[model samples]
Target: MSRIKKLLMVVVALLLLAVGGLYLYKDAAVRSGVIASGDQVLGADSTTLDSASLDLFGGGLALRGLKLKNPEGYQQPHFFQLGGIDVDVSLGSLLARRIVVPSIALDGVELLVESVIDLDGPRLNLLTIRDQLRSSRVKNAEENSASSGQRFVIESLTVSDLKVMGLMTIPGGGSWPIDLDVPTFEIRDIGKKQKGVLLAEVVGIILVAMIDKAIDMIESDGSDKLKIAGDIRRGLKFFNRGLKESGLDPKLGKKLLDDAIQKGLGDLLKKKKKDR
Candidate 1:
C-alpha cells in the first residue's frame, strides 16, 4: 500500500476507537448526572441507581433500580423506589440551551409514607421530603440562573403500577401498615409555560402531585382508618402553609383539601338522615 493510504487508514482506525470508547463510557456519565441531579434536589446523598444504559445515537435511556433513601430517623428502607425508568430524549435539542425529553415512563414505583413521633414532635417522611424539595427549588433556581445551566422540558411523564404504603408508629413502638394501590397517572407539558424549568422544579411538581393523590385516597377509604385520614389532613394543611411561605401558589392544595372535607361532611349528613 502507498504511504499516504496507510496513514489515512491509521487515522480512520484511531477515530473509530475513540468513538467506541465514548460509547462505552456514555452510560456511566449519564448515570452520574442522574445521581447528581437527584441528590441536588433532595439535599442528601441518598440517590442511587444500579445501572444506566444510554443509546449514543438514538437518545434513549434506561435506568434500573433507582431508589431514594428516607431522611435520617426513618425506619423504612427507602422513601421512594422504582423498578425502572425509560426516557426518550430529543437528540437535536441536546446541544441547545433547553433539553427536551419527549416522554418518561416510570414503572413499579413504591412510595413509603411513614408518620412518627419523636423528641422533636410529630413528623411525616413525605412532609419532610416535601420541605426539603421546596427549599431546594429556590436554591436550585438561583444556582441555575447564575451558572446558565440548561433547563429541561418534559412533554409527557407517566407513572404506572404505583404502590403507596403508609406506616404509622402507634403507642408502645408498634407500627400499623396501610397499603394502597394507586391508578396510573400522567402529567403532560411540564415546563411548557416557561419554555423550560430546573430539574428540581419538575421533581417537586411530581412529588406534590403524588402526595395529593395519596391524601385523597386515604380520605376516601371509608374503612376504620379515620385516624390516618386525620393525620393526612393535618399534614396537608402544614404543606399548604409551606407552599405559601415558599412563594408558591397554595390555592390548588388548599382547594383540594377543602373539597375533600366538604365531601366527607356531606356524606356524613346524608348518613345521619338515612339512619333517622
Candidate 2:
C-alpha cells in the first residue's frame, strides 16, 4: 500500500471514532436532559425514573421503572407507573434544544384509582394535567426567546399493555382491574408553532394522554366488555380470549369492576337527565 493511502485511511478511521464518541456523549447528555425536562415539565414530585439509557443505533432512549406521583389530596402513591418507555428522537432537533420524536412507546403502563370512591373515575393527577394542557399556551415569544428554550414534537406514540387497577380505596369495595389495549389518544399542534413553547406544555400532552387512556379503561368495560372501541377493539378481544385460555376470567375475576362500571353508567345517565 502507498504511504499516502495509508495516511488517508488512518485519518478517516479517526474521524469515524470521533463521531462515534460524540454520539455516545450526546446519548448521556440527552438522558440527563430528558429526566430534568420531565421533572420540570411535570411537577417536581410528579416524574421519577429509576434508570435511563440511550440507544445510539436506534437514535432514542429507553427509560425503565418510570413513575408519576399522584397530585395533591390523593391517597394513592402514584397516579401512573410503567415498567419502561422507549423514545426515538430527531438528532438535529435534539441538538437544537428541542425534542422532535418520530416515535415513542410505553411498556406495561398502570394507572391507579381515583382519590374518592369513584372506582372507575379518573385520577386527579392525570385530570389536573389534562386540564392544564387544555389551557396551556402553544406559543410565547418571550419564553421561546429564552436562552434554554425547549420544545417537543412527537409524530407518533404507541402505548402497550396499558392497565387500570383500582386500589380499593373505599371500604367494602373489592379490587377492580380494567385493561385497555392501546387506548386511542391524540394531541396535536403543540410543537407546530415551535418558536415559543415550554416544557410544561409538552409534559402536559403526555400526562393528558395518560389520563385519556385511564378514562378509556373506565369506559371500555361497561356491562359490555364485548364492545371495546377504537383501533384497540381487536386487540382487546384477543387478550380476553387469551386470558380465559390461561384459566382466568377477566370479567368475572372480581365483581368490583362490574359494580363500578354500572355506577359509572348510572352517573352518566343521571347527569344527562339533569342536563335536560
Candidate 3:
C-alpha cells in the first residue's frame, strides 16, 4: 500500500476510537446525572438507573430500570419506579444554554402512596416526597441562581401504564392495601414561560401533577377506600403549600384545595364523625 493510503487508514481508525470513547463517556455521564439529580430532588433513600444510552446522531436518549427509594420510615421498598424512559432531544439545542426536549415518554411506572396512622396522626409518603421536593427547589433556587447547571425546556411529557398503590398502616400494626389503575396523563410546555428550568424542578413538576391526579381519583371514588381520601385531604394543605413553594401557580393550587373542601371532604368528615 502507498504511504498516504496507510496514513489515511490510521486516521480512520483513530477517528473511530474517538467516537467510541465519546459515546461511552456520554452514557456514563448521563446515568450519573440522572441518579444524582433524582436523589437530590426526590430526597430518596437511593436513586438508581440500570442503563442510560444516548444516540449521538439521532439526539435520542433511553433510560431503563429507574427507581427512587422511599424515604426513611416508609415500609415500601421504593417510592417510585419505572421500566423505561425515552426522550427526544434537539441536537442543536444541546450546544445552547438550554437543552430543548421535544418529548419524553415514561412507561410502566409504579408509585407507592403510603399513609401511616400512628400516634402522630397520618404521615403520607406522597406528601413527604412533595415536601422534600419543595425544600430542594428552595435550596437550589437560593444556591444555584448563577451556577452553570444544565437547564431544560421540555415541550411535552407523557406517562403511561401507571399503577398507584395505596398502603395504610393502622394503629395495631395492621396494614391494608388498595390498588388503583391511573389513566395515562400528559403535561406540555414545561419551562417554556420561564425559558428554562432545572432538572430537579422538572421532576418536581411531574410529581406534583401525579399527586394531584391521585388525589382526585381517590376523592371521586365511592368505595370503602373513599375514607382514605379524607385522611389524604388532611395533608392536601401541605400539597397546596408545596405548589406555591415549588413555583407552580398558587392560585390554581388554592382553587383545587377549595374545591375539594367544598365538594366532598367536609361531608365525608362529617359522616365519619357522625358514624363514630
- Which segments of model 1 are wrong by more than 4 Å? 1-18, 169-176, 222-224, 227-232, 235-276
TM-score of each: 0.73, 0.57, 0.72
Tens digits of lDDT, candidate 3, 58-117: 989999999888877767888788999999985677768888899999888888877643
Poorest 10 consecutive residues of model 3 by lDDT? 167-176
Q: Candidate 2 on 5-46: residue-level lDDT in tens? A: 999999999999998887668646655665665665555756
Displacement of the residue 9 alpha carbon in candidate 3, Å: 13
- Please identify model 2 stretches exceeding 4 Å from their true place: 1-28, 97-99, 117-125, 132-148, 167-190, 193-199, 220-276
How close to the true structure is residue 197 of candidate 3, measured as C-alpha lDDT?
Answer: 81
Residue 128 displacement (Å), model 2: 3.9
Misplaced by over 4 Å in model 3 are 1-18, 119-121, 169-176, 222-276
The stretch of ten residues in a row with the least summed lDDT in candidate 1 is 167-176
Window of ten residues with lowest summed lDDT in model 2 = 167-176
For model 1 the local lDDT of residue 206 reads 74
- How far off is residue 112 in model 1, in Å? 0.7
C-alpha root-mean-square deviation, candidate 2:
12.8
The lDDT of model 2 is 0.57
Candidate 1 lDDT over residue span 1-276, tens digit each: 999999999999999999889778988987898888788787668889999998757878899999988988877868898899899985567668998899999889888887644444345687788778778877866675665677888999998888888764322112346688889999999877767887767777777677667757654452245444344444444433443442324584344335434554244435545877
